[model samples]
Target: MMLIEETTVADDALPVEAFKAHLRLGSGFGQDTVQEPVLRSFLRAAMSAIEARTGKVLMQRSFSLSLTFWRDAEAQPLPVAPVTEVTRVALVARDGVQTDVAEATYWLERDSQHPKVRAARACLPQVPTAGAVLIAFDAGYSAAWDGLPSDLQQAVLMLAAHFYEYRDDTGLSAGCMPFGVSSMIERYKILRLGMGAGQ
Candidate 1:
């Protein structure tokens, strides 16, 4: 299965002012405006890192999951969490033709941790050969930054500040997340228990 991001978070949705405030940049000095581009980059990077570590989309956006066959026809689990809506389901043919699935055949199971697509009746439609099925859905906390959890907001601020402070540090390893951010986001991490592992 492949998950494709259709629409990304809007630039305006980012908390730029909040990030600047966290870095203690004063408005009167004009430094904030001078470093706006750097701040924006750091904010984006921090948001991405946090999302990757926690498996939670910080802002609302659209995504498409494509697959050759359903993992489970009755209830296919979506990869991302906090899915707000499933916009459409389509069947792509070998010749590149696409057909939309009927709305009556399926429904979204809205559990914040494990949103899924469940068959409305007994079973779902057969998966076509030589093509793919695409499920389009929206996932995230909310469209506004204020909708983010307080801890996540704090984590973003902390991480962004770290990035800003270490802007020229090439010694840092790839995907080098700070300890404070990790600890702050620990509770949001998804822990999957294997069979009988929960016992």
Candidate 2:
């Protein structure tokens, strides 16, 4: 299985000013925007780390997941949540033939932790022999940074600050995430399922 991000978070959607304030950096300076590029890179890095640890997208964006088979035939769980929509599902054969799955046959089962693409009836559409199933969807909290949950928003700021503070620390401490940041995101992390979860 492979998952690809289809869209990038827009620069304006990022909380650059908020992050600078969080870091207590001087404002109103002529070069205030000079450090923006570096700051944005750290923010992106922090967001990526947080998202990976939580299995939740903080910034709204599109994703495409491709799989050879389902872990469950009736309900295929999405990797991230909360999924806003399932844009498309299709089968692509090795010979390059494509078949779109009818939207009527499946529904998006919304869940905070385990959103899924569920068959409306008995089972989902079949994966063509020697072909792969492609699922395209949008996931995340919101398009704007302020739309994120308060805890999550604070967590991002805290983590980003940690990263900024340790920019020169190439030792083990540089790689360590603060306990508070971990605790803040712990509840958002997806719980592991049983052995049957594997395909």
Candidate 3:
């Protein structure tokens, strides 16, 4: 499942109009004809709306902006991040279980400076899971955990499903995926058959 939401930063809080004008002038978009003020207002409103929905405030200097209009309709453009990075997923066995029926832990690593993780962390306790934990990160990270027992696999799957659903709805991109729960269950089943294969 995926969560969908908007994120924005206030226009009044940044010199967006000036920045836009600078871009137009540099790009030869006719500095005299550029409506910087109107563009600024539109950007401010759009950014504010996104921020209000997703609780993310983007730094103006960190991104470039663009706008387009067609006939009587116009689209509000979003800032694009230049870097592409992988997201890490990890499963930790809760009680040192080595089989498929053990409890586990799930963690997501994203930029430590992201406000979404901070907000999510504050609301973590309200998630209703007793042993669940959330962690924030600044760079690419990965982890390996001991295998979990069968009964716990279902619970972890439920949590992973919820996360997948939420992220799918939200526009943010991350590479994390649920692995341990099902993999361990399959491994345990094979082991019971006296097979020596492991995933």
lDDT of 3 by residue, 60-110 (tens): 222222111111111111222111221221222344322221112222223
Q: Once model 3 is optimally superposed onto the true structure by TM-score, how far is the C-alpha of residue 95 displaced, in angstroms? A: 32
Error (Å) of candidate 2 at residue 17 is 0.3
Q: Pick by TM-score: which candidate is best? A: 2
lDDT of 1 at 135: 94
Worst 10 residues of 1 by lDDT: 190-199
The TM-score between candidate 1 and the true structure equals 0.93
Error of 3 at 42 (Å): 6.1
lDDT of 1 by residue, 8-98 (tens): 7777788989987787877886555787777888898998898888778888999999999987779888887889999999999988798
Poorest 10 consecutive residues by lDDT, candidate 2: 190-199
Best by lDDT: 2
lDDT of 1 at 39: 82
| C-alpha local distance difference test of each model | 0.86, 0.90, 0.29
Q: Write the per-residue lDDT of candidate 2 for residues 31-96, one digit (tens) a residue.
A: 899989889988998899999988899999999999999878999999899899999999999896
Distance from true position, residue 24, model 3, in Å?
Answer: 6.9
